[model samples]
Target: MAHKRDKTPRLGVGGELWITADGRNLGSHARMGLLRAVVEQGSITQAAKAFGISYKAAWDAVDTMNRVAGEPLVERRPGGRGGGSTRLTERGQRLLERYAQVEAVHERFVEMLAREAFDLEQDFSLLKVLNVRTTARNQFLGTVSALRAGAVNDEIELTLPGGMRLVAIVTRGSTEALGLHTRAPVVAMVQAGNVILATGIESMRFSARNQLPGTVLTLTPGSVNTEVLLEVDGGGRLVAVVTQASAEALALAPGLRVTALIKASDVLLAVTV
Candidate 1:
């Protein structure tokens, strides 16, 4: 008697695709659709209503896209009687066209894959392995230089590119689970907020386990916080976020020397395998 095939890995062709610039999400279907809606409706309020999202959310998304993209995607035009109307900029139209092209190609690719009847389970597993998205702004590929195992948490020293060393504290169970050992290749992730920046206080040693001195490369100030990019001595870039007030207090500026401080516990560890 014939048996029914397993339907564990039921594949689908639908998924959200997005574009990011400088690690900031710049465009997506939802955002592009909002832009299109605004162009059609001629008002942000109307567009938001059509998109079923709040006015503030739509405005904030447009603001972020504009700031991150370094180009205004939408513009407000002053009218005779009314205040203003929303319209897409030339670049915005081009962006929408480009996104449409990419989405078409992506859909075609998925359709082709589906028609081929590929090993659904194996393909999905591989794709899952490749999709390593994390919120941490700082990621480094390194090798475990040293590991000290204890009853509870294990201390690991990772040697990164450009002669930099990062320290991570993990549970002993995690250490064994990830097969973390001396000379094991691993990735270290640290959130930008976790990294503290210190300038002109290098003489005073901090309690933080990791401190790397570097030169400030760029400072991008946002409304609430500022992102400072630093180039480490050997060869690596570190990102640190500080409040506008703190940035001003520290006098963060390009070419200024600063030290990045991170606690070992703040560092997260991951392995490809």
Candidate 2:
């Protein structure tokens, strides 16, 4: 097979990530690169240099990942004469495989944006790196502000730094289950449809939609669902999972005044609207 020119890179979407959709936060790009290089070179020092990180930093990342993953992704096997060489475990191999798969999709998505979202450079005026997930599952993150007890679920209100509020109905038992309370940082996870997108002067402005001016931060092409990130004022950000066709039509970008449409329905309203 003919090898093609190098292309595509995965970047972190600013703010909030659902682990279900994003794989575990075992480590980030540099860390993964370091791991792969270490496995290839069989030396932490060489791998660290290959990835442009210090030997100690690389070692730290590996240690932290091993700690968080609850499994060793790398193993050191004694070499005949050269002391020892490093190799990935079955667990490590699977981790690398999943990472590679996600990376391919990520690169492909960036390419899709460069083509489909041409105005992104002009449309997006702001962006920030909030978090990255190994999985792309539905999730939300914010500071908990209010909580109410109910017959069934506890209505918990999460207020984002930008003055946006999200109310979630968690079972009273489940609320107790999570031991949630005010001022607590929480992440909300739901289906893709749970998130909505809107532009200016649209009749479909979600009452739950948090309005802000932003540009198309990024667009990643998904086989079935495309992902779009919008950067809002004051470094605020949000992600919209929409069809590729829609993203092309709206031409969402960085300097554009796009309202992040979230349905109060998807998010509970703690106070009367």
* Cα-based lDDT for every prediction: 0.86, 0.63
lDDT per residue as tens, model 1, 119-192: 54331222223445788888787899999988899999999877899999999999999999899988888999
The TM-scores, one per candidate, come to: 0.53, 0.41
Error of 2 at 117 (Å): 31
* Stretches of candidate 2 exceeding 4 Å from the true structure: 1-141, 190-193, 201-214, 222-224, 263-273
State which candidate has the highest lDDT: 1
TM-score, candidate 2, is 0.41
Q: What would you estimate as the lDDT of candidate 1?
A: 0.86
Candidate 1: the clashing residue pairs are none
